[model samples]
Target: MTPAHHQARTDGPPHAPELRAAARRLGRRRFLTVTGAAAALAFSVNLPAAGTASAAELDAARLTDDPFTLGVASGDPQPGSVLLWTRLAPVPYQADSGLPAKRIDVSWELALDERFRRVVRRGRATAHPEFHHTVHVEVDHLAPGHVYHYRFRAGRYVSPTGRTRTAPAPHSRASELTFGVVSCQRYDQGHYTAYRHLAQEDVDVVLHLGDYLYEYAVNSSAGSRAYPEGTLPDLFDRETVTLEDYRLRYALYKSDPDLRAAHAAHPFVVTWDDHETENNYAGQTPENSVPPEEFLIRRAAAYRAYWENMPLRRPQLPDGADLRLYRRLHWGRLAQFDVLDTRQYRSNQAYGDGWQFPGPESEDPGRTMTGDAQERWLINGWHRSDALWNVVPQQVTFSQRFNSTSTPSKVSMDSWDGYPASRERMLAGAQAAGVENLMVLTGDVHVHYGFDIKRDFDDPGSRTLGTEIVTTSVTSGRDGSAKPANWETLMAANPHLRFYSGLRGYTTVSLGRELARADFKTVSHVTTEGAPLTTAASFVTEVGEQGLKPA
Candidate 1:
């Protein structure tokens, strides 16, 4: 479930013809804007090509301010390759990211040590103004299961050193794997204290489930952070709509020190839920008020900005409003992660899209949560998985969450509970594929939840199929309590729900051959900086077992 602001809208289904027509209009508009001479210069050098910038060609001396202010990041690691990212944002809030209307040469180095004395790979990539002067370098031909240090240099200025690691060899018998999970960090709700603590954890990688940044406006005071007046630009006070707006929003969010520290410390595998575009959006359908064609234009802008800002590879780049984000990652023989994109190909929420009672429309087998193609992809991936643990890093809760202990309990329409047929298909697929150790990692409700994914929700003694670990927000709800007001009722109503906590923090999981352990880490407060971190709870599920137990 999301915040109250994402109210349910009872809009009819979206018309495909109108959406296609609107996309053509938007494409023509973009073509006209990019036909100028400056646009030509920006695109000419923006090809995804690798080359070295000569010493004389480096513009470091001309950059008075550090162009690496947004910091460096890595993501989508493979056994022999990894993606490194950095934006030349001397003035991040500006439309051009404080760069001229041309391309700039950015050099990066991958070293065996942090001191750069033993450099392994070094290359140059051209950052074009068309892409907000951001660089995405895919460095390959590295050792498997090895740690590496990376940094970017544009002319004379160098970025902060970032730590990254490659996955273990595909057939290697890796003993254990540990990773952090986080989501829903609304910049205006609270401080990013959880991220500060996460930066210090000894995790291999971080899976950001969604809502990396909200689409809402930020005031001059910078929300709960209480910054001094005029700290944020006036442009951020409006909801993100255009490509420039989305890019600037990313700049402002990435400008935070704690968020930057987390990125520099570990690689992040990210996916979006809804706030990346609009709240409760279903497929190409808008929330309610906007027309389908108009919404498609906004969706295209948002998708392009998302690709430009994240540390994703070339294949993940958006073609209009579509991005192939659902993929699989392997960590030796220990775990296989199936990262999912639920927001992009979901059916419109039944009965408007908020909390609602179960009905025929919501239970239709044709209605999909991951669309037909992705659903088949997931099931097929599971059938071919040889790893011990089949872990799913997805956006929403996969278990049924009952809001009240009544005859007709209400469940979130935006979560899996609203699409029971989809959930059933996923569980059946896993069972058919003989997935013994199933684990689902989720984040979206802004509360920590541990549930036993039962084969049948209505039967308390039904067979447990897997375990779902729902991490709380990084800083969504300003300052949450140890137990929310509905704790007791929800606990009593849902017997499969093993644990629940209303705290602002994340969850760290350690996957091993014998068992998988999860630690719910929470911060004392998020309205102020330097909040003390604590472990709210711990649970574990053993290999070949499907339910969670106290660890």
Candidate 2:
């Protein structure tokens, strides 16, 4: 498919040719206020002669009462900019999104106030059909540590207003910061009640550790929602395997009002785990032993759909079948967030992917959860970081979890326990870096856990180098029980495990100079809507400490 070029449309604001010409010659600092309108006008003046459709022509054919079904989102906030996103879908969940096979201009606005009285920036961007009509505008040159409101417009329709904030200046000092941790919200299992509550939290950013959507086939037993209406249609009963399938699945998930509300409320940093493509996929290899050639095609489709729907910058866009998801974000001098991608570059699971104690083959020094290149990047970042807190947000359990309290203990081959060499090296690196407060935030396992990260898990008195907090699922395993079947065995086998909960919810972390507080929030029910929420447990890790204490 050819790249789209935007043309002036009736739905967009009137052009300013003189201002556009002046903006073209202005410097970066001088163009902040005028760049938005100038760029749109300049983009309009350069439209090609062929293959363009007027806004009226397109609107008369397919416009509906509302086209912003997916709502608004902002992410990847920097000191000077934030990425704003919205998809124009009049009749969502369809192949064409009920629009002609062409591109349309979308107008956008950013303001100092929600009422649009003090408009800061206004612009237009092209929404191409090839990319599912999603608009991602990077609003730049904004003041640091300031909140802004944004929205999109198309053909007389306006999207819901979204709030976003830029990070503080690099050299500035911050005393405290708060963020929400979430993952594994399977649409088929339950309502998005966790997101509904998370939307109202006072947080700086949201770190999504993965499994944003599952690839499982829909069934009659999926939650309590009726089929062909509130739930998935029979046509989508099969697992996703193609580009259209992935796009449609994303549309289905984005249609949830609660989930949409959460995205609108705060900026999010996202990374994906197994279910985003297929369960437990490793390096180009499928979970069920399909040929790599067949799996790469599916991976490419998933990657493209993910980039289209996500509020990521151009640098993180998919190249062929790969994406660079592991990166870093900072909150002034308070915290440094290193978001990781554990699934993309990993070796195949050892011991055929389950709970067991494998031989020395699983302890191979060359094997890594994050491939060699990403490991070097992470280590380098750790060594270079000077922030008070170093936070690692990633998927899967980091600490070793044993099934029994006896010798020759068994562990899940799917987690870091399966790659002990890599886990040990990470702890050693953190120790070598002499970080002030090293904390790891994790997801997957459908349960919450607070534990001490030791340099050596085999020894009971090993050096404590960091702390690990594993958040529970948003709605993965339905309304799970308070105590899982193997709860006693796990707790006895791993004494470092301070807390655990088997339920559907998320984790909220409040980071300060002295201590970091983590609230393990849970929902009473997910099989139904409007579930009541509560803080099941709370833990605090003091600065310079490497373990969790009850708060």
Candidate 3:
């Protein structure tokens, strides 16, 4: 942990030098431990010999600590402003007990280009423990329909470069918009080739549908963290039920440079899924969370961490143990993203773990995926939005998906199928509101799917009110699980599904005044690092079109 003993691992993999140099240049001198079996991430940044730092460099580095260890990131930008976030972790592990009392002054800048030669706006502020010391300055006075490069500086340390953009003014006659969508990325399960790929995509915002962290203990699930092959250190020593545990988990996840870089480059619109709290939490009870008495305490911790880590509006800030998650984001006049909270306010599990027949409590007319109140809000948004595309950014599939129905029902009861009335409410809302270009962008289920959101799944000829495009997991689920032929015999029974993919990757939805397109960005491999991404499938919807069509 000392600067004097810091030495880069010479025997490390290809990114060793780049990782060390990047860390050293960014003033991350204390810890450099490489983590994960992925070897490609330069691990947790292994520390070297104490002789690695020079007196002069050490003195300068001290002036500006935590330059951009977590990297630069932008999110939820409106036409006039955007959110810039970065934790000022001069001493990342420094505790409230032994922490320095002085507040660090961090300055940020926005430029028209990456080089920063033509500066647009600049400002400075103090980062302290009041808000966990994470700097979230809602930079205003930005021009609409334009891209800008941003960075932060504290003393001699310069932050990593990030890119952000503002939406065009309302009804500005915008011609087109392209945004990258991703969610549920478990660090150790795979390399972030998707983030790397996304950094290169010309996207304005990244629609992240949560599961940013898993509550499961290391290796207990699919992959390990901070180590390779199922090796998971007590990330928080146990399941995160207290605020500190959530804080620690966020710190661990934000440590990934790839994730950081993507955030720095593009503004993100994010919503938490079940893992943010527990596997699949009911109202106050967490699915698989122990001590049941600790449910509310765990929810409080998770919500607090979610707000503290995300770049959200002031109203969305955490209050006590509750944090607001549902909101709306409009990208010019092309698309309006209605982000939903599927887990926060919801009915109980409704079913047993792992898609069982007639999910446990699903039959209860009282059960709900998104509590009644939240569902009402969604209905209101659908009926009110006027954007060309009303993209419902929810945590799970909106269309009913039955695994099989010919012999016996095998579809997941936890999905919308469990809440038929709710799905009907959504369909009726869209229909009654005369909403156009209604599209659902979903995540959570480790499979990719495209569907025509009809009024009823039992009747395919039923009116197709909208379209639902579900992206697979970022790095969570393993591939080759079984071709969704699980529905082959039941295709005639439940006709809502139009397409499904059992791969791992993200989705990109592009929109113009006349048409909207959904592209599945799938990687060649997930177990290995640096896999190439390909367009596995593309679906398009014309301006007057309401259903999904193969592209």
On lDDT, the leading prediction is 1
| Candidate 2 weakest lDDT stretch, 10 residues | 40-49
Kindly report which residue stretches of model 1 are placed more than 4 angstroms away from their true locations once superposed: 1-60
**Runs off by more than 4 Å, candidate 3:** 1-65, 90-102, 219-237, 289-293, 351-354, 359-365, 479-494
Superposed by TM-score, candidate 3 places the C-alpha of residue 371 at a distance from the truth, in angstroms, of 2.7
lDDT, candidate 2, 191-227, per-residue tens: 9999999999999999999998888876644555444
Write the number of the candidate with greater lDDT, choosing between 2 and 3. Answer: 2
**TM-score, structure 2 vs. true:** 0.89
lDDT score at residue 261, model 2, on the 0-100 scale: 94
TM-score of candidate 1 to 2 decimals: 0.91
The lDDT per prediction is 0.86, 0.82, 0.70
Clashing pairs in 1: 60-155, 60-156
Q: Model 3: per-residue lDDT, tens digit, 434-486?
A: 88678888888877778888776667788777788888887787443335555
Model 1: how far is 500 from its true place, Å?
0.6
- What local lDDT score does residue 132 receive in model 1, on the 0 to 100 scale? 73
Model 3 lDDT on a 0 to 1 scale: 0.70
Provide TM-scores for the models: 0.91, 0.89, 0.82
